[model samples]
Target: MDMDTFWNDFQLVRTGNPLVLNVTNHVVTNNTANALLAAGASPIMTFSSREVEDLMKISGALVINIGTLNTQDIGLMHAAWSSANAMRVPVVFDPVGAGASTLRTSSSQELLSLYRPDIIRGNASEIMTLAGEAGQAKGVDSSLGADAAVAAARALAQMHSCTTVVSGEVDIVTDGNHVYRVNGGHALMPRVTGLGCTATAICGAFLAVNRNRNEAAVDAMALMAIAGGMAGAMAQGPGSLQMHFYDMLYSLKKSDAERLFSVTRD
Candidate 1:
């Protein structure tokens, strides 16, 4: 990945502050919103089906998370997704804990069947499960490694005709035809709740600016990995890591990417 191009895209978000409409769950709502602000994207979290279409008019991107799914909220998510599709805004889907429950898995499948998401970001188990692989998820956490889900990610991408991101110690971003591996994040990242959700939200921000959806997803993973590495180095624990994470996101520069950006095309 080119650091100059990546820096330019990050600056676009900082300057443009693209509005991102999120029909996300309550569990990680505040965390994801704060992450979007740190990444210089405006976040609007509203699940009201009545106003989803109106909100999509000004949104540059839409992110739908099924972390805390319910019947009523599913309708709202579908409404938001429909509006996003109609508006031609990029949609990023986070199938949180997809394999952990029948409802979560079925709801995720339902959404995918209804409309194709521009990008689908999840952990190894979630991606594997979504791809119809024999994946075992310990609740929302992936029981398998990221590399174990590469084939599944590729299949899922090809099946849906969209990008798939599998997050782990080494993140994998694939558009079925091309695959990119990003390595830099720390173990402390998973200790914090909603960091994965934050990554999905940040992907939406990058997608809003970059026309190349594949590279946009790659850059988003790169940003997370590099920034997480920086924050982990300075943080004594997960609490400080979260604080330093926001700081790193707001102040990230090409120099930081130069030092930590480790990506390979496969």
Candidate 2:
């Protein structure tokens, strides 16, 4: 779908207020929940293995975030993902810091191998590592460029049969067949560590509302970048930007998204 229709889906998601189940880490729980509500989606953050399957059964989509990884959390994430996939609910995966630790990196890959997600969002270094690069990562921040790993992203997408999104100065979204690049974001976004995880959860909310998530994912990514850009202009720095970011998200109109959106397909 084009940008206009993308906004329509966001509106549908807003009005429908699809219930999105999140199995996220400790670091980004608050940001992720706020972002989901700001975008007019219901956020349900639950990690209890006892209730995860039941929650996924009722929710619109499932979001798995590896922001805070542990042995037990990994088991719950795997169970939630398995249930979500079996039910055909769109699943989004965020491998927060893939190359940071052997356990984190291995768990991320294991999840992907076990249940390929509908969409996966991460920075260049994370994507490159997920695509089998040997480069080191600086904590969760990307040490690689978005453009440098296009081939790896594509390869990963095809191999996993899942849409891959690489966000940097410019964001790249690909579904193995189609690739879109979105430019227009604030520099302050990277300063906030959990923003990327928030974006992945936002993508899950988008997939929840639209039946065709290929288009919904595209729109979600573009709208997120656009919102970040606009909010950056209105704020002093990352602190204020975080507060202003939610305001922009809550006030976002479909018209604004279409008007300011910058997209290109390659």
Candidate 3:
């Protein structure tokens, strides 16, 4: 897609102000909500199964993140997924730390098997683990680069019939047949703890505005990479990058993307 078309998608999220419901983990709740807000989308963070049934009806999209998983969270995740599938609301699934623990991996796989989300976003290790390939995660961090899991991502996308986004130095967006490689994000991005979860939330915002799941995924990752790269240039470390990232998203312009957008399709 051209810069103009991509910028249009970015503006759509800003103008439409779609409501995104996130049933995310405790670790990144505030970070995810703020990221969504910065991207010009309304965010409602909740894990209550009772209210999610009603919330799904009004939300433009749903995000499920398993960063801090438990038995109660598992039930809530299933409830939210069921509600989203029933309401036909687009769902973005983030399998955070999928390769780190048995519960994380099993819960994520179970949800994917039962309900097909609109998109799946995670690191290479998490994606590979979910795809039933060999990969390891250091807690919630990936042990492999994003490029290492392209094939596994494609397989997972085909099996689940959803777009898959692998976040790393080069973010990979794929749907079995087509692939988009988004490069140019700052090297310091991985230094942040909840940045990956923030990326997933931003993707949820894009999915709320754009119906083309593949393009939406690309737009989300490209926006993150461009904004992060810009922010990193002025940041001294991860602490400052986090602060500048929000500012960048709020004031993002077409020229910024024109200069920093480095995406290739395959």
Candidate 4:
């Protein structure tokens, strides 16, 4: 997909808006909320099983990020995922650190096997782990390269029958068929805690408006890469990039965003 196509979707989110319900983790709560608002979509964070079914029925999309999962939270996620499934609401799962520990990998796999996520976004290592590649993940970071995880991503996408996003310096997105590579991002992004999670939220925002899940996933990654790259260029370091990245996100002109995008299919 082209950057202009991606830019148009961002504009569409502002114009033909949708409500996004996030049953996400706590680590990047504030960042996720702000990013959604900046992108011109409404974000509501709640994991109550009581309200989840009703919420799922009402919201345009439902997002589940297992970033900070506790026993109670996992229960809530299962309930929320079930509710989302019943309603067929677009579900986006960020399996953060899917390969970190037995618990994390198991929980993520359980979610995938049970839920109906329209999109799954994570770094290469996380995707690799989900593909059952034998490796230990140190928290939510990736030890695998982007290209190295392509087969795993393809397999996982086929296994889950959903659009999969494998993030990296040059991110790759697919749906068991088409593979779109989004090559635009700063190395400093990994230095930040919630940037990847932030990207998940952005995907949530785009999915709020876009109908085609694969295109939306591809476009969201392109936007992240382009915007992060531009913001990083202006940043002195990760600290500066934190401020500049949001500024770039808010001040991102469609034309400028298009110019920065560099996605291709192989």
- Global CA lDDT of candidate 1, please? 0.92
- lDDT for each candidate structure: 0.92, 0.85, 0.90, 0.83
Model 2, residue 265: distance off in Å is 0.6
lDDT over C-alpha atoms for residue 144 of model 4: 72
Write one digit per residue (lDDT tens) for candidate 3, span 1-266.
Answer: 55776799899999989999999989888887888888899999886798998898899999999988988889999999998999899999999889898889989989998997899999999999999998978888987999999999999999988999999899999998898999888999999879899888888888888878898899899989998999999999999999999999999888778999888998
Tens-digit lDDT track of model 2 for 77-128: 9899999889888899888889888887999999998996888888887888
The residue pairs that clash in candidate 3, if any, are none
Clashes of 2: 0
Worst 10 residues of 4 by lDDT: 133-142
TM-score of each: 0.98, 0.96, 0.98, 0.95
lDDT of candidate 2 at residue 252, scale 0 to 100: 84
Ten-residue segment with the worst summed lDDT in candidate 3?
1-10
Name the runs in model 4 displaced over 4 angstroms: none
* lDDT (tens digit, per residue) of candidate 4 on 101-166: 778889999988888888889888888888887544667887776888888888888988988998
Worst 10 residues of 2 by lDDT: 210-219
